[model samples]
Target: MDGRQDEVAGAMARLAEGDRDGAASVLRAALARAPDDPEILHGMACVARASGRADLAIGLAGRAIAILPAAHFHITLGCALHEQGHLEPARAALHVATLREPRDVRGHAALAAVLGAMGRGAEAEASLRAALALRPADAALLHGLAARLSGRGAHGEAEDLYRRVRDLCPEEGAAWANHGAVLFALNRHEEALAVLERADGLVPDVAETLNNLGLVRMALGHLPQAGVALARAARLAPEDARIAVNRATILAELGEDGVAERLLRGVLADPVAAGGAEGARAAFNLGTVLLARGDLAAGWRFFEARTRLLPEGRWPDIAPWDGVAPPRGRLLLHAEQGVGDALQFLRYLPYCLERARVVLELPPELQRLVGTTPDPDGLIASRCTVLRPGGSVPGDVVARCALLSLPHLLGMAEPPPFAPYLLPALSAGAGGGERRVGVCWAGNPAYRFDRRRSIPPEELAPLGEVAGVRFVSLQHGVAAGDPPFAMEAAASGDWLETARAIAGLDLVVTVDTAIAHLAGAMGRPVWLLNRFGGDWRWSAAFDRAERPCWGDAASRWYPSLDLFRQAGPDMPACAWRGPVAAVCAALSRWRDGRLAGD
Candidate 1:
């Protein structure tokens, strides 16, 4: 090869070795000889990208493509644009690369990636299939299709493809990692661990692979193992913001929020680290830390970053109410979170700005519960198996907002009045005054923290022993079976009957579940058995300090409800202990009033 070509090859070698400075130096010399050489310009662009100079890389790649119109040059430009979050332009550039070299496998893969990011799932899958047909067993193409399908929520199909990729190409580290990720997404943690271990064994501990393993381990409640994996990942990739965020989460779970807060803050301060997907996540973690410390203003500000983290089309087309009082017309308020969250925030409806005319869109399971309440202007119950725009709503809706956003929008410095928001009853009373008490021991199992929040049925045996207290079951779901206490079966999936049962009860005691919120909203006497160091909303530090509402046993959020926290320092979050003895002791002090304390 001639001297100019030799210089280009040497520059490429330096780029491959991650010596971007040396690569650029050599590329400059080559470009000096052949000022318009596409190969030299492309080599410089790759070097720029290696050093995190995406704009410079795009500029050089554009110059290279202008000279030679090569697929490799456009591919480099597309990749740089993708990293910078310019998906549409990236897709256009990648499309040009595919046209320039129809059989360019990497170009097709890059195009597929950009298309997926743009939410064009079908086109992305087609691109992958086209590339896969050329090299049917290629690990990259197979893994691409597998990841695309997984992103589409087809975990079963993704798992099968991921299994094939791993088996067919045992030496490829990505195949193993992809298989493990899909398994974890499917809630098959044991299989996920096995697959991740296989990947770690093959690659011997890449930062991303170890990070995924740590996440799966954390989900399985193996805190020590998760800590070990996450610590190692942080060491390997100290600059990776996601590793720091994951480590912070584990630390918070272990009740070490002080250190976790510092780690998350450092990630947010680093511009490069706080950009892309990890940026919004760091903001979220920081928001939780601030909220836990009772810093509402800053906490809510950072918490709003959640919208940026969410995927496209997660909400409807209506403009979200920007914390403003409407002139007229009904505001379409919808529940965007879990049942418990929806129930908990309903207290804010009466306090809405200017006594706003509000309509609600709730899941069908919650219809019967809301039916007892006469507050909302109107209610629309619908099934949301697949999300889309324009849910059933009344006409003349001026704006929309998720129910969870109300507290922040209202600038609520303190909890609203704890008076009963839901009406008295929808069904006839149980007709007896034999000290009737209702109990719930479990929450929706699909909740991420259900294991920590739910008390095992066997642990509730103490409640059954309380003399003169009729223990009725308010428990729902498949977990509803024989409570240690006697429970009359209400119609399955019937929430109104459960409400009626609660209305007739002298007191209701429950763990952190939707029923807890329901009983509290009804202004009935209730005892909330909380886990140690639980969700921030339950923490005494969550509310303003001077109002004197939060105590060890009292909550500002609900005046009729008393809280009984599990013993701390030794009570693990994943334990099966119940606070029934606390309830029994309080029942002994009861004066037979509607409120527990009275």
Candidate 2:
């Protein structure tokens, strides 16, 4: 072998033994004999960078690149620059490395990383895809692309790629874990649990997989299994804000919000939980916890974090109005959630008076019913936008904020105007001596907690048998079977028709759906059936210790409403019957009171 080759081989052997000083000595000796040899210069540059002499490394790598203009020499320079946190220069060097090699995996990977560091995510994705194209069967490159896609919210395509990656690398625990996470996002909890379990067998100590397993179990209402998994994950990754938040969520759902409040507060104080997306999420979660416990100003302040949690499409760049009546600009209130949420929060829109020329936006489902909203202060003359998915927002609007954020802006400690806000034009009164009670046994199926919040229509069959009470269906969907009520065949689609029907009913019995919100706003008396893991609004209102452990029977938002919650697991599988019976018992007493008065 040549003298220079002998010295380079000796340097590599020293570096392999973790002897940086010995490696540098041998590399310098080689460079002295062949002053501009690219091989010796490349070896010297890598050794210098490893020893924390980035300036020396960069100079030697530059000399090597000038001698040969080769891929490895350029890569060595890029690594040296990256070690010094010189991202832009590193990016340039890596780009050249990729160009020189054309198909080398290391150059492409390094280029992609530098591009990502420089906030060029799309270009990084392209670079990674290029690497994958060269090594189509490579599991790591495919997995990397899948992770990037998932981060960008392209879950459907990510899921497909994750499946491919899992098949290609069955022993890779992270691949299985990520595949399970995609399944969780797609609401395929059963598949997620199965895959996560498989991952656990391969790599039992992985915190992320445990976190996902807990989440899947929680979604299925298996709280004990979820708690065990989540607690374990929290212990494993005590510094991961995501794991801590998930643990807190389990506590919150199971009516242990006090512990959740503590856990979330502790996590928020830690550096890991104090910034970035995790910080935003923790802030939003803390808002919910504090709000549930009746801390208004603090909760509302933290609730501002919701803006950060949402996608850029959902939360636009227009200056958000800070609950102040703007002196000179038109204020836009954009709907950021479902039609039901639009209905619930519409009360706040009219309050945004001559403060600004208002352009309110809401979902199409709620457009027809907007006419019925109370404008006692007299402002909503301008037509609001009926937003559809992928539709462009108007360019004329000045400041924009989400409709759900109204309560935080309004500082609403005082009770809402209890008088009817929705006095739709009266339809003909029903001809019956019996008290007509409207019933809604379901909510939109797409809602994440629909499994816990909505009851099957058939579960209300027992209530249908009540004497002197006629049950009328206010449900909207393809029923599992013929409804056990007297809903008019003509009364199924339009929100206005539904409003008119609800206005005519003597009372309404429903789950925590938008219909309940509508009926409550219209001054109709309602019995709101709540799940054990009820919503934050209901928890805030009825989570008093003075109430029965079973549940509270009153509402704060809907003054004319009564709440009935599902019994806890200790109460028998027949706990479902408790809410049904509560409504029936209340109905019977109302009938008796009417008869006695007559």
Candidate 3:
């Protein structure tokens, strides 16, 4: 190569190595010798872009393109325009560059970035795939495509591409963090934690990196570590609503409710955060905190913001049922969250029945069981019709309401009706043996809070020591592993079948799952294995000192239920021995009482 070209090459190399000063010095010397040279001008533009001087880079790139209209010059110009937030102009420039040199990867890659920023996701993905076809093994190309896929919620493909990127560029902290985030989305918390820990070590001060690490730690139930990482992230990006929301959630979980509430309130009050997705999350989290502290009125109001968190088109075009008046025709009450949620909120059907004809939509799992629920006045069997989710709505249906929205819509200042609302299957007969106790050690693993809410099966071993009690296993889907105690497997074909088994037991002990809700609805004696800062329904247990109770402690929501909470927020799931020991002692006391009665 000639002398001018050699100087430009050296400058480009320095710029690629992040030595912007060295690149600038080399480009300046080259410009002095050949002031009109396009390559030297382009090299200077790169240095200016790397230094974050997008305006200067735009000027230098324009000069290079004016001297000799080249594809590379247009690519530089497009990149500078994109950096300056002129997305349409940047897209036009990149389009011209790609048209000029259809084989150039940089032109296509830059066009993809501009398209992505413009929210033209499909076009951007197409451009990225075209660029990848030319440079199949490029780490940057793979990472970009992976991020696009991740944004589109194609986590399986994103995970595979991120794996390739990590293998190709193991030292890149961003690649590791991206990979970890994909794993976290896929619910592979252990792998995500390992990957995020590596990323935190490599980029300890990066707010986004620490945020991802904190989320992974939180999912693994490492509360203290999560708090530390998220605290640092919040400090680094104080104005970032997403980071603030996450940090506040961790604080709430850790019993630092005052600080958590303050952070969440600030986010809700900020104009930028108040209208965005993060703001909605902040509002929902604030509601949780308030409800946990027994501020029912404000909690329900703020909790209304959760509807904003739902994806667009989540509901049909039908008008929503306003809590104010009885629908002229049928009121559709649809379940929104988990089965446990549906079971808990089904109590509100009678309230809806009081106003209008009620159409209750539920998951198929609970259809048979819910069909068996009876009302002393025969309202349920006569007026309320059970429909499967997405089932055909009757032509007379006028408005719909989410099952969980009942309390909020009704403006309930206190806990709604709490009574035995379900009937045990007739087949369920009384047990005559040792006091039968049904036990469930875990909940649905797919749930976001399952790690914290679920107990390790081995912890149930202590219950074996409680004499005069027969333990019946109520766990479903997955094995709870062998405990020191003999647990008879209950015949649970469905929710109704489980209810049958539960009806026969003298008492039920379980995590926060559908079984707990079922047993409570049956007015069966139930002990809840509640996690610290668990679901809002269990708020009475969390703030029992301030919360009013109709029956025993923590049974305001379910008069027949009791609660066994984690000793503290920072206690890991494996350290569940404390609650298990408590249950063991309680069981022994109950046994002694029964013996004394006999």
| Best-performing candidate as measured by TM-score | 3
Q: After superposition, how far is residue 388 of candidate 1 from its true place, in Å?
A: 17
TM-score of each: 0.69, 0.78, 0.83
The candidate with the higher TM-score, 2 or 3, is 3
lDDT of 1 by residue, 121-191 (tens): 99999999888877878876888898888978998988998999989988877788889988888878779
Whole-model lDDT values for every prediction = 0.76, 0.77, 0.84
* Candidate 2 residue spans exceeding 4 A from truth: 1-36, 44-57, 267-280, 294-305, 308-336, 348-359, 374-411, 426-450, 455-494, 501-509, 540-552, 569-598
User: What's model 2's lDDT at 23?
Assistant: 91
TM-score of model number 3 = 0.83
Q: What is the lDDT of candidate 3?
A: 0.84
TM-score of 1: 0.69
Better of 1 and 2 by lDDT: 2
Candidate 1 least-lDDT 10 residues: 379-388
The TM-score-based order of candidates, best leading, equals 3, 2, 1
Can you write out model 2's per-residue Cα lDDT over 111-148, one digit (the tens) per residue?
88788878899999999989888888788888878888
Candidate 3 lDDT tens digits, 191-288:
99999889878878889989988888887788888999999998999899999999999988888889999999999899988999999999999988
RMSD of each: 8.5, 5.4, 4.6
